[model samples]
Structures are given as C-alpha cells and as structure tokens.
Target: MERRRSSSCKMSLCKSASSSLGYVDSSMDVDCGSGWKYAPQVVLVKIYSFLNDTDRAIMARVCRNWSLAFEAGCLWRRRRFEMGGYRARTAEFQASGFAEKFGQHLRYLTISCNHPSLVTCKIFQRAMEAFLPKLQRRAKLKEFRFSRLEMDRYWRYEQLKEKLILTLTRFLRQQFCLRVLDLSYSQFYLSAGLRIIESVGLSCGHCLRRLIMEDIFHSRLTVYSGLRYKRAISRFTNLRTISLNYGYLSDDVMEILRGNLAGKLKTMRVRVYRSDPHGHRITKLAWNGLRRACPSLKVKFNFESIGFASDIIPILVAGIPLYELYIWTGFDDNSDWRLSSILNHVAVNFKDTLEICNFEFDNSTEMIDDALFRLTQSCVRLRSFITNAVLLISTIQNICELVEQRKLDPRTFHITACNLSDLEWAELAYLQEKYANMADERSIDFRLSSDLIVESRHAEF
Candidate 1:
C-alpha cells in the first residue's frame, strides 16, 4: 500500500512539472466561466508569462483565447529583438514584421546590431522605418538600446553607417521621455554620437534618466569635440545614471554633471579604455566635489588595460563609493599582479558596498587565491563575482559558501571560461546535490545551481 501511495505521489509531481513547462492545450471552447478553456483573462495572461517567447508563439496557435493572451499589450511593452543562432533560425518568430505590429506597445526596446543579417536585411530596415513613426506619435517609448555594433571591411560600410546614423537620429528625436539609452560598444564617431545624444536631449531633457555612451570609436581624422559633448549633455537636466568613457570626459563635463545640485544623479559608470593616450583629465578636486554633493552616489568603474590599471584608479577610489568594478586586462607577459595595487584595495577597501565584481583576464593570467578569498570573505553585499580566469577548486568552494550563507539574497558566481576536468565537475555536482537536499529540508529558498553558473552537465540533477 505504501509503495502504491509513493508511486501516486511521484506521478502527481511529474504532472505538476509538466504543467509548469506549459504544454497543455485543448481547443474545445466553453462559456467564460465553465472550465479550463474559459479561464479568466488575468489567469490566462499570467500563465502565458511563465512560457518563454518561443513557447508563447507556439502556444498562440493553440486557441483564440491563448492567441489573445499572447498578443496582450502588457507583455509587449518590454521587448528585446536580437538575432542569435536560435532566434535567427526560428521561422515562426516573424521578427521581420515585429516593428510594424508592436511599435505602439513598446515602452522598453532593445535591439542588437551585432547580428549582420537582422541589421542588414531590407525587410527589417523597412519595418524599423515604419515603426519609428508609431513611436514618434505614441511618445511612450522610454528605453532604446543598440549594442555591440562594430565596424568591418564591407564595401558599403561608410555608406551604410551614415544611413544607420540618420535613421537612429530620426528615432531618437521622436521620443520625448526616455529613461534608459544604451549605445555602448557601438564605436560610433564623436560627431554621430553627439548628434544622437543631442537629439534625445533636445526632446527628452527632463525625463531622461540613464544614458550609457562609452567606448565610442575614434579615428585619426574624426575630431573629438568637447564643446559638442558639453552642448549635448547639459541639455539633459535630470539624469540619474550615466556611463561615459574617461578618455573624452574633460573637467567641464564633470562640472556640468555636478551642476550645483546633482539633480537625481545616483549612479555613475566610467570606462577607461587604453586607446587614448591622454588618459583621464578630470582632476582630484572635481571628484571630491561630486562626492561631497552626492554622498550616496556609487560608481561602477570598468578599467581596460594591456598592463596594470591606468593611473586614474587612485583618483577614482579616493572620493566616490566604488559599488562595482570590472577589470579587463591583457596581464602583460609579466606573470603576476601584486595585490597591493588594485585587487587588494578593491577587496579590502570597498567591502561594505561593493556588490558586483568582474575580471576579464588574458589567457596567461590566473587570479591569485588570496585575493579571491579576501573578496569572498569581506564583501558582505557582494552579489556577483564573474571571471574568465580559471579559478582553483578551493576558490570555487569559497564562492559556494558565500552563496550558502547569503541564501536570502540571490548572488551570482559565474566562471565563464574555466576548463574544469570531468572529475572536478563531478565533485562539484555532488556538493551541489548535497546542498540542494539540505536547502529543501531547511526551506532555504536560494539554491546553488541557479546562482553558481559553472559549466557542468549534472546541473539539473
């Protein structure tokens, strides 16, 4: 009898799992309150939310109610259209017609320029052109993102770039109130970048909140216009968050941001790239003034270097609160970086408020164990620690411990490129399963698998 009951219980759990996976469908329509076919609109919409975009698209074909729920305006507000290997190949996506259909519904829109086909396709271009008019009229659009656009050796590169900039400018000028705009890694010319920001500022001014315009591409001929930058940035009077490349930021720009009141400015992200020889021109005094004005403001600093961190780390770490830091360096052919320089200061100094820490190192470099320990142990608010460098087994364990202790708040420790042996992976899997059982028994909500994203096959198990 006990064995039969156990089998019944297992069957029920499997059914529950299947339900959550969201494949249940039947076409026998009934009255609004009769049965599953006639579930309330809210309930149906909520169920639709659980299914991913692909599944939702497939499910939409199941029934009229399901189709309506899938097309409900609420779900379409925040949209990200990118062509990855999966998305590009998916015939059912109808990505070509997305802009024409859902232009008015989009409050937050993110489109990737990294995909060659999506950006270059004539159908997509026409759709975008049609879409921009809808946004212009609606004026409800709040976020616009075009990320990972880089130059190449295509014959019509210059011609296409000019056309793209014109189209982008037209789109930007239409939106009157945008909260977030990301143009990072786009490698846009200074003039073109200025024009885009100027368009937003001319329209969006007071309503604009976060602007990410760093790592802008520069060439020998394209001039760097501080005046143009000042003109464009000063128009946005209520910016709460901003990310700008340090190479172009003059003292005037910093002063403009300070602007006597520091209106709504809470977060500042600065990227220091190695291409520019001048380094950062903002003085220690300007940093101090900004810190004094906005004591609660925290900085997310990304420093990219071929060798050690640029000399500006001292000036930066001195005044503002270092909330997050990412160091991407070639690590020089010289084997080791002494902790005293940047790592020790980061691990020891900003332990209280430092939440996100990431390091992208070249192949030859390995993170020192001591630094990882200090980072793991000290950072009480540390939410993320991601790296490409291969970490030691003990180091990985320390990160796991961090997550286990901070079970209430979700933390992420990701090793993106660590080539772990099968044996090592198996050991980690064992520990993972052990923790899973313990977490379940104790009713601890956070599990290590979701938070600790390592390359392991037994992750689901």
Candidate 2:
C-alpha cells in the first residue's frame, strides 16, 4: 500500500509542473509583439484609402471587416445628389444611415433635380438635413451648382414658380463656403417671375462673382415687366463678368440699363434675336450701354440676326472697344448680311486685342464668298474665320490663300457646310488644292460638313 501511494504522488507532481510551463510560455508569446492582430480601425482605414465614397460605403456594410471603413471620415469627400431618379444598381441612396456615416468629408456638393414636386422637395430637405450639418462641420465647401432640369422645357413653368421661393430661401440661408453659384435652365414664368428675380437679386448680394442667365424664354408678363432688373443689377458690385441670352436683354431694353449697370460693366456678351422689331433698339442700347457703362469694356457680341448686323456693326464699332467678334445667323431661315465694311472697321479699331473673328451663316454661299473675299482683302489681323453651311467653296479658297501666305494672323479656318459626307468633298478638294498651291505657312482645319479630314495642303510657306 505505501509503494502505490508514492507512485501516485509523483505522477500528480509531474502534471502540475507541465501546467505551469504552458502558462509561462503563453505569457511570453503575448509580450513578444509579433503576435499582435490587426484591429477593425486599422483595416477600415486601409479599405477607405483604396475605394471611392459610394463603393467604400457599400463595402463597409458587407461584414464586420468593412463596418469601420465607413466610420473613417475621409470616405465622404465629394457628395453628389442628383435629384429626380438614378438607377438603383448605379446610384446609392442615403437610406442606410449614409449621411451619419461620412458627412464630415464633403467639400464639394452638387444638387440636381428635374422640376421637384412638394413631396420631392420634402424628401430632399430630409436628406439635406441629415448630411449637410456634418458637411458644414467637417469641410469648407467652395463650390455649389444647383441645376433645375426642365424635361418638356415648357412643362415646369408653373411648378418652378411655386417652388423657387422655398428653394432659394433654403440654399442662401444655409451656411456654406460657396464661391460659384450657377442657376441655369430654370424656366421663368409670370407666376415665379418677380420672385425669382427678387430671390436671385437680393440673395446674391455679397457672395456672387459670376452670373449667367440663359434661355429665359417664358411669359410675356415677366419679359415685359423687366422689374427683375431692380434687384438683379443692384447686387453686382463685385461682378467682373456677365453673359445674357437675346431673350433676356433685347435691343429695346438698353434704355433701362443705363443708370443701373453701366458704371460697373466690364466684359459683356449680347446675343441678339433679330425677329423682334425691338431688336434694332436692343443692339443700339448694347453699343451705347457699353460705351457709357464701361469706358474700356471688352465686348463679344454674337449677332444672331443677319438683317440687324448691318445696323449693329456700325454702332458696335463706334461705341465700345470690342476685344472679340463672333457673328452668326439667328435661329431662322438664312438671310445674308453684307459684312465687308463692318469687318474692315473692326480690324481698324481694335487692332491689338482681336482674338476671335467668327462668322456663321446658313445659305446663299455666293454672299458668304463675297464677304470672305472682302474680309481677306481688307482685314489684316483676322485670327479664326468660322463659316457655317452658308459659306461657299470660293470663300474657303480665299481664306486658305491668305492663311498660307502668312498675311492673315489666324492659325485656323473652320469651313463647315450643310452636312458632312462625300457630297461636299469636291469643294473641300478644290480648297485643299488652292491652299497647297499657295504654300501656306499656317495649317487650316477643313470641315466639309462637320468632320475634320485634313490639314492645309499649303502648310509649307
């Protein structure tokens, strides 16, 4: 009995010793630092660094490995919320607490919607409330462009009027570091006319630098009232550049703009619509306004009506110091306006700053040819002569000759006729041959329709 007891005691002692040894080894392994595992925080950062905002947000929800990826603030840098509808598989919605996840990194935000309804506005407001606070807190957003898309062009005229007030209030009131605000293509009608003018004119006081009003063709009430100018022009102390379509400011409206914006105007672009009998007055006003408002303003007036250019050219030459000139047939049946004398006058007055001299006409190729011949003979510093379909083959040849001889200061001549096909190839070939014969120093870009096929054949002189 005594021997058996001693043997059992020895076995017990050995088991205890082995257990102690294992514990000590385990402690040593942990302290050695080589056995440290990667935590969720580190892994999330690595994932964010590799992917874009939308992708990163998606992957973060996949599993435990990705949850932390979204929590890291840098993943939400640029937030683009295109209103209306985006396909589900392509665009991600903020339904899954996305705003709370990465709102801090939004530096640039663009909000686009097509004639948003009341319900749509509410939903947008909710989303904005969710994300914008975080963005404002985290990033100093520098640029914001809100585009209100009009599908039918005329369908949303009434809807825009009702909603524009609320929309502008929300946008301007929101504390953002916005430098450039572009509100284009929002159809203006009588219902929303004065409100829009008031909202933009009043809200953009100290914040705006550049303003562009395009294609504002709406109700006659707003167009005739022209009351919007009261607020619109008053807030332009810091404005350096302005571009307006023909519909917004016709020739007849120049009488109203004299004391309003004349002193501050710097660079102006007037797109004249010729159909209105008031067009002549508008053209005259533009010339007179530029001369009076800005002593040395650079004007780039696009003549949309050929009939009016005859009257407008003289006014422009006498009134303002035009830096560039681009003339084209307005959106109607082609009407040829003799441009020789006008071209000569431009070349004579603004000799130093003449950059782009372009003419776009539709038909009567012979008339355009005569215009080109006269321009080539008289104007010495012509840069770019862009002729639409109305230009003839002979005109192209003459312009090419001047370009090849180095007599014309321009580097390119874009000759476009009706359509691009083999139909106009004969004329193109003839012009190419003439250009080659002249040993042209400057290469010309030739377009039979719209496709550019060859450089000037006379590019060696």
- Highest lDDT against the true fold, candidate: 1
lDDT of each: 0.62, 0.51
What's each prediction's TM-score? 0.67, 0.63
Model 2 CA lDDT for position 69: 47
Best-fitting candidate, scored by TM-score: 1
Off by over 4 Å in 2: 1-107, 112-141, 151-161, 175-177, 190-194, 200-204, 216-228, 247-266, 273-296, 303-317, 327-354, 376-382, 418-424, 430-461
Candidate 2 lands at a TM-score of 0.63
Query: For residues 198-237, what per-residue lDDT tens digits would candidate 1 score against the true structure?
Result: 8888888778888887754552222234677777778978
Candidate 2, 423: how far from true, in Å? 9.6
C-alpha positional error of residue 461 in candidate 2 after TM-score superposition, expressed in Å: 20
**Residues 107-141 of candidate 2: C-alpha lDDT, one tens digit per residue:** 55666765556545545545544445544445555
Off by over 4 Å in 1: 1-40, 50-71, 83-96, 117-127, 151-156, 216-225, 260-263, 276-278, 309-317, 335-339, 343-356, 359-461
Question: So what's the TM-score on candidate 1?
Answer: 0.67
Worst 10 residues of 1 by lDDT: 6-15
